[model samples]
Target: MEKLYEVFPCSETQKVLLATYTLKDEARRDQKVSEFQELKQGRMSVAEYEAKFTELARFAPHIVDTDYKKARKFEGGLDLEVFDRVGVQKLPTYVEVLDRSLMAEATLAAMKQGKAPATTTTEWRGKRSGFGFKKGRSFVSKKQNTRTSNSSSQSSGSIPVCSDCGKRHRGVCYRVSGACFRCGQPGHVVKDCPP
Candidate 1:
């Protein structure tokens, strides 16, 4: 009470009015809950979502009490891709969700930068051996493969691996020579790389 009085620096009547002013009115509480329900983690960072959640929770703590409920709520607002990646995760608490969400955001960012997102490739039938050329028409140069074989023998096994994408292949790596020098990724030149 003394600390409050000292910090506020107000008379008794003023303090009473201030206290009433800071009181959580029912109308404001309902509004906050509505805002919380509408919250989405679209373009904002996870930190921003968490901060907003914290603010709104002050008005409606009941809505986010349990770990399951809190985690679900947090997942609901995530960006489409991030939400898809982390949605199936069974987080135990709001804090766990926050931490995992940050990790998911980082992964999404890395994926945007051209790093392949870790995903299970169950359907291998539809997948191609490497970028460019149909099956047997791949462009591995015989001279280049023979000369580079001893020097760059990353794959000692029977399955030949491409230097660019690291995928196994039978013939020359079509992406090896013509890869974009600027981005260092296969399949496109520097001028064709995304802006």
Candidate 2:
């Protein structure tokens, strides 16, 4: 009777506790922790990547113990384009970084579709310049004239004509159809084409 009790434990709680301890797999937990460390956004969208990140994060609590650490860790796994856009904002929280990454993904998608305004590129550059020009100043006038000339040359009949295909389109001709600017191929871009 004493030997059986020693083998099986005495009370129900003790038996359950012993079984739970016996089932715990330290190697499996370590594998999860390693997976979290190697996680990347890759081809996944921001929401999908976020779901995976949350799922894995639980296995590695010490790495992301603080809000800032968690935010940085999340940012580090973003796709290159999204990471570049979100990194420039220097957001302080995980939520802010995630939101900005989503926004950046949308903006990139719009740009790829040629639905984004041409001014968006110039406006972003202007904001980053950190030099404010007064209205009617020589510098401002020059900048405005350049923008006007560029837009006027690019616009025709409400739809912008694509320089690549010489066709009237709402968005970029090459990007909208995913064609190479150089060889006009769909699978690759101009940079990878032979001259």
Candidate 3:
């Protein structure tokens, strides 16, 4: 406030005209309009956004300026989803856009509370709750599966299975390439298995 007062330095004789009530009001209004242009909804509630809009609009009559620049500026401050839904191209007038945005906001609030909007055919209850993965489904590598099948047919009894990689105990397990535990060798495991 002191800085603003210092900015418009005028002699005491000229102060009466510059610091008049009307001039001060106009300056305040101009500041309000400037703030309105840079406004962003962010995490503000719909009511808070509307209140700010209304407060700023009262100060700036040009908020309904020609070519709808003011309207576009107002819409730009809204949430991206709301802006995309009821932008200048979509809505015919600023009034319509404002109305649609309010309605959309209400619908979104309803959805957050696990209630479907009036337009929704299916009931909304937040996100679907269930196990992350589907039941009766498991991964089986093709190479491992083929090798397991071959070993099952070749071996008379149960074939050895590694606890780590879950693959048949060949010369080298599928995952572990070197340092075979069986023979304690680098390149090979127990038997001279086929590549």
In TM-score terms, which candidate is top?
A: 2
Q: Write the per-residue lDDT of candidate 2 for residues 20-112, one digit (tens) a residue.
A: 665576667888999999999999999899999999999999999998999999999999999999898788878668766876786687668
Residue 44: error of model 3 in Å?
A: 2.8
lDDT score at residue 179, model 3, on the 0-100 scale: 50
Candidate 1 per-residue C-alpha lDDT over 86-166 given as tens digits, one digit per residue, 9 for 90 to 100:
778776666556666766776677567654333223212222332222235555444443543443343334444657779
Q: What is the C-alpha local distance difference test score of candidate 2?
A: 0.72
lDDT of all predictions, in order shown? Answer: 0.64, 0.72, 0.57
Winner by lDDT: 2
Worst 10 residues of 1 by lDDT: 123-132
Total clashes in model 1, counting residue pairs 3 or more apart in sequence or in different chains:
2
- Candidate 3 residue lDDT tens string, 111-156: 5766434422121111122111212434334544455445535552
Worst 10-residue stretch by lDDT in candidate 2?
Answer: 130-139
Please give the lDDT score for candidate 1: 0.64
- Models 1 onward score TM values of 0.48, 0.53, 0.45
Clashes per prediction?
A: 2, 0, 0
